[model samples]
Target: MHIGLISETFWPDINGVSMTLAQWSQGLLDAGDQLDLITPHAHADTVGLEGIPWQDAKPFRHISASRVPLPGYRGVKLGLMLPKAAKRLWRKSPPDVLYIATEGLLGLDALRYGRQNGIPVVGGFHTNFQYYLHHYHLQWLTPLMRAYLRRFHNACTRTLTPTQAKKNQLLRQKYHRIHRVGRGVDLSQFYPRTTQERSLWRQQHGISDDTLLLGYTGRLAAEKNLSQWIESYQILKSQHPSPVKALIVGDGPWRDHVLSALPDALWLGELTGEALAIAYSAMDIFSFPSMTETYGNVVPEALASGTPVIAFDCAAAHELLQPGKNGDCIGVNEAEDYTARLIHLAHDYQQSPQRWRTASAKSIHHLGWPTVNASFRRHLVQAIHEVKRHGRQRSDFVATKS
Candidate 1:
């Protein structure tokens, strides 16, 4: 079956959405399906957006990134050239069904064009744009964002999500045709590794054998609540005064802000492949206080790395925690409580790492990407069959009625 994927971003970009797109595209290609991906090609500059060449890896790739123009507050806009982009791919060979990801202009354009052409449309529920508006201090933009997401998703046959938690939340807000597409990780790259990794990381960071290392991995932005981590880190050092080093992996707009605020913390910059593996292995404990994540991909990856994590019991924590054995969860009732628990864990690092190793391995071993990919392939096929069986026009495609 030929499938079309329209996302706002794709690979070589280090974010959760792009990673997931790469995973799903590869998965579909592996399942003996061809994919036509439509997205804003970041590298090119066309009137609206441009296209970049991408090669497929089998049952697994979604190639050829197409771009479009998008406007924003920064004197520039980034987006996909929807109708033109889709037409370009369609001319080669259109897919049996179209899947839209991201709540961006590019995705909406693709969905609109697909419907006009009688192509069955489906969607993936990724970032909650409305929720983000509030976090960005754009309270006035919430209603507009909400309406845009609602109208955009309403046009699809189904909107797939990584967790039932997100699906239920979207449904409560009246999101139509929501479906669950469980997310999994690559166990091979993120599983328990004992010796060489830890030693090398400690050496690189200039830490002695007795030092306790606490780390955070993922984007460092205002939404992540990194300020609290700094405050909490200060409190921990002052109260207990242990030889603890803080390691930050990954970079974002907040890099300067973080460096200015916490001058002593080791900045590993952006890490990938084995470097990412080494960064995770080097850390003794993982702590995150980010409020903006839909599902903190790092939590599962940390657990898979046999590194214990302490996170507020919301979203990702709500989904991944088995409690005490593998990880420690902070109460969602308040933010201070989250900070307090991280303090407690920092005071005693030995027990947390030992217990976390066993639990982390348990959590990641069975969640290989193959499982999630296979399920998605079946879902795409099923949506295609549903359209055919019902003979619904693209514009007439109704989200699965609750």
Candidate 2:
């Protein structure tokens, strides 16, 4: 089946959504499904990627707001994608399925085109635009963001979410055709028992053996609730005479601010491939404060790499984190409690290494990309069947009237 995937983010810009889409596209291509991806051509004239298979890529009209940097992620842009751009490029090659990923302008445009043209439209929740408002002190806009999100996802034939809690939340909002599309992990890339790797990674970053390495990955911007992290770290420092070391992977607009906030932390800018893998393996504990993620991709990645995670009770924590099994999920917005957990973990760093490694390894198996793709394909096929059943039902009613 041919499927057209549209989003506001793509490669050359590596975030969770972009990477997840790329992996799913590869898995679909392997499954012999043709994919035509509609995304912002942020970098014009960009060509084939390295080590990745050949794929079709297209660009759309970039809005003035399109180029604006996400407050937390310096590398990614937050803009409305013009659906007309999808229309111009995809009208001829429209797929049996039109999968929309983001809720920005481009997504709306794609939804409009899909509805008008009678193509099956499916949406997947990738980011949390509402929780972001709280980080930036725009908490009052919660209703607007929720309404916008509900309207967008409701338009799809089905809305795919990674967690059960989110599914319930969306259902309450009256979102249509909501379904749980489980995510998978690349187990080969991340595993435990890398002592030398941990050593090398630590030495490379000047993290001594006695120093507790608390790693946090993702954008360094405001939406990630990074101030909470810093405050937590300070709390750790105030109690413990020895300062715990922090390793921040990934880059964003907040990089400069992060430096100003905590100049002493080890910053590896944006890392990928084996480098990212080793970074994950070396951390004693994983702490992520960002509520803007529908699913925090790095949480699983960290787990697979054998590091235990610490996140608030939301998003990926609700789906992937199995409380004491894989990682710890702090109470909602309980930054002090979040900090205390990390501090407690840091004190017992030596004891946690093996337990966390085992937990991480166990959680990784559930998220195989091939498995996720198969289930998703089934959902699409089922949705199409439902549409057909409804169409035939309508036809029979008209025949009876005649």
Clashing residue pair totals per candidate (backbone < 3 A)? 19, 8
RMSD in Å for candidate 1, one decimal? Answer: 4.6
Per-model TM-score versus the true fold = 0.88, 0.86
What overall lDDT goes with each candidate model? 0.71, 0.72
Best by lDDT: 2
Off-target runs (Cα >4 Å) in candidate 2 are: 42-75, 78-91, 241-243, 322-325, 392-402
lDDT of 2: 0.72
The ten-residue window of minimal lDDT in model 2 covers 393-402
